[model samples]
Target chain A: MIMQTIDLEADGLRALNATLHAQKDDTNQTSWEVVNAKGSHAIAVGLDAPIEVTVRGSTGYYCGGMNKQATINVQGSAGPGVGENMMSGTIVVEGDASQYAGATGHGGLLVVKGNASSRCGISMKGIDIVVHGNIGHMSAFMAQSGNLVVCGDAGDALGDSLYEARIFVRGEVKSLGADCIEKEMRPEHLEILRDLLERAGADAKPEEFRRYGSARQLYNFDVDNAGAY
Target chain B: MCGIVGLFLKDKSLEPKLGEMLTEMLVTMTDRGPDSAGIAVYGADAAGQGKLTVQSDDAERDFASLAEDLGTAIDAKVSLYQKDTHAVLVAPADKLDQMRQALRELRGNVRVMSAGDTIEIYKEVGLPKDVAARFEISKMGGSHGIGHTRMATESAVTTMGAHPFSTGPDQCLVHNGSLSNHNSLRRKLRREGIRIETENDTEVGAAYLTWKMQHGSTLGQALESSLEDLDGFFTFVVGTKDGFGVVRDPIACKPAVMAETDQYVAFGTEYRALANLPGIETARVWEPEPATVYFWNH
Candidate 1:
């Protein structure tokens, strides 16, 4: 595998993304290193190749967003909207993540080795997120379909107004939102949690976690509650 | 959206570089807000001396001989240092009130930016880099500082609308979001005799903190109360004589990132503003939680 080193400060973000987007499925440049990331937004975004990019330092907003078949790793903390709307790829953050991590994604895997800020995995669609540390408030709000696994504590209003999404928590939840309640973990959920934990390098056991999902109350449209709308 | 940057130094060795570091951080946020910019620096204080930062659109006519007139009116020795459209008057510490009153009577058009023993505020309607250059902020030295780049969501683009609004002696506030109930709150605060100068929402925020502090609440306590009192979104970074504090609203739609090291404590709307700070790679960085008050004092 050939390796490419791109200096972000010298090459510019547009040129770097263009280079990554130009690669085809059988391209020999499979590995890329980004130096001097320095909290710039939209690094390696909109990539459809199966290349691997490693950011050398902390990044600003939307790092590795809308990724497809790419494996991007951040060596430091990530700003807001990391891996947003990603499709069939993996993003790993060694440090903490800012707000709305993996928001509105259709399919992918995002692993945060450190804590995730508020609105983590909000409105997620089919993305699997594993946080080794705690998650902030309103995580997975209005989530249509996904699996959000937390190895640490969860903040307020976890998984509010969800639809068919599964949430697993290994620590105490501060408070649950309307219509979101804990459900009994079955064998299938345990199996899914075990696989996600192992893949994300989390040390917690699947049995130590609890599952929470929507109570399906908000989905009904009743004539009696029309004024509340 | 607006941008906010604050630096509070724990090590004395970093004191002289405070302004330079803060200027760099403020300029990096130009993309967040490009309409106006302002900075507040808490510099060294001399015994028995207080500093009054005043601004005037007509610097040539208003600032000249204004110090002599103020000194004569207050019957105290005074010295003036002018920068861009603002000037700092160093006068007797006990006579700050009289000087402020006398200046009001002497030059009705002059605006008092800040009045305290250690604080000097410089702000204007320009890009952050241009504003910092006009004030020579990089050359100035301070113990701690806070800066803002305004995008003008709630108010007009004017010198008075720029952030780092100083409502109390040695206290300044920079805001990133707007307040929904500022009009009603402004009326109430004015009924209680708090001075609010503009229709700007952030001025009301600064005045509210001043009102709370006047009623014997600490800065942290005042900030904690603001979460309940002030409505709409806000992420505020406040600078006082001895401390720097940050507070975000309950929703926390506005962003704020904080970094703390043994040498200093830094706050920015994003990590990009803090990328150039010394030892930042090793600093403990995280986003400030919602409706929480984080403060550091020297």
Candidate 2:
């Protein structure tokens, strides 16, 4: 097992991020440190091999953009566009993230322990992004294909212009977007959510949650249902 | 405290670029600072130096005569001069250095500020829409401009109380939070003969930086000085005619974040306000730094 530890200082963080080529399984873990890392875009990028990277504190923008088969974990918060345009990987944030997390992801799992800001999974292609806390407005706008699960409340205009992506909410929804509907809950969703929670390390009980999914009616174009959508 | 809208145009025509979006963004943020509001539209037939700001205390000397004297001192035509405010503007971004020098030549309580290309704000207490409606804002068109809405605090919310408060000839400030050391810094500035206006703590900060800019200190230096000198929980969006500036408190109490892309860069009190931009892409979003001074050329 090959392991790497970085303190997230300016010099060390820059030096480490400057030379991260996924040759084999690489694991980098960061500890608690007061690092005034401001606006260093694309903190982690372009990794195809299966590697695990962890940042213990809060991070700036695009923490794991353009990722491929890498697992990134943050014990603290992350900025906007975390796990953006990801091909395949797992990015878990233990705390709240700014707007647009897991945006345009092709395939991967993004588990956020806390609430997410507006447009949580915009234009998502194929991904499973789970949230334990409430989400802000326009959570799944223009989603092509994915699954966005929220255990808490969702803001106005939830799942606007959704396509093929399924959304499950166990809490209140302020408003529904175009082509989105609240469907019936079932037993199989409970098992799926429980497994996702276990992977994300959520402490909520499975029984307290409810399920939601795509209505499938909006998947195909219709002339009469124009106003409904 | 005010509303600001900036547009970066790839083409020369500034309009149709930010005409509608700027109106929406400014109107949405109107509730934040509502003492006064004004828009500096930069587009076609636009002069980089929109107006001349004259500051003076010549006993009984008239503001119009002061403008005439400034015109004589600089040997230029004073197109519009009203009660301590004067403007001798040119078009098409041609006279950059001469305009800066012409404004600087006339010395009185009168100072010509931002001669190259900028908007001079003279605000009063009112709603943003009414105040902006009073002034015709479509003449001075350029690629980008900033607007402000203010609420009075320490001093009265007078014409001077409004913001994009010009702390210097080129620099202006519009703050969202309060300053802790108001009286302490106010006394210091007063003893040094710097006139203090408005009881708002934001003005103290504005004056502190104004004094520094007048005395040849850079805006960055003034901000660094306030980082240690003035204590408070503050978030401000400051800038010059050609640049952008941002800063926040050390404790991180108030929230201020930026969402940027190839086309536009926007900062809002919250993320919900700036969610739908002109051409926002999924992968080109990020938050600006908190509790630090951030700036850009845009």
Which of the numbered candidates is closest to the native, going by highest lDDT?
Answer: 1
| Model 2 lDDT per residue over B1-298, tens place | 3444444444344445554554455555577677665443434334433454443334145354544554565565545544323333442344344444554554434443333345455344577666554443433445555566655545566555566666654466777666778988899999988977557687788889888877877887777677777788677767665666777665444545565665556665543335446554332444444446776664
**Model 2 - which docking category?**
incorrect
| Candidate 2 DockQ, CA atoms | 0.04
How high is the CA lDDT of each candidate model? Answer: 0.93, 0.63
Model 1, range A1-229, lDDT digits (tens) per residue? 7679999999999999999999888888999999999999999999898889999999999999999999999999999999999997899999999999999988989999999999999999999999999999999999889899999999999987778889999999999876789999999999999999999999999999999998887799877645533
DockQ of each: 0.87, 0.04
- Candidate 1 residue pairs in clash (backbone atoms < 3 Å): none
* Model 1 deviation from the true structure expressed as Cα RMSD, one decimal place: 1.2
Off by over 4 Å in 2: A1-229, B1-20, B38-50, B53-74, B81-117, B138-140, B153-155, B213-217, B272-276, B281-285
Clash counts for the predictions, in order? 0, 20
lDDT of 2 at B143: 50
Q: Estimate each model's TM-score.
A: 0.98, 0.50
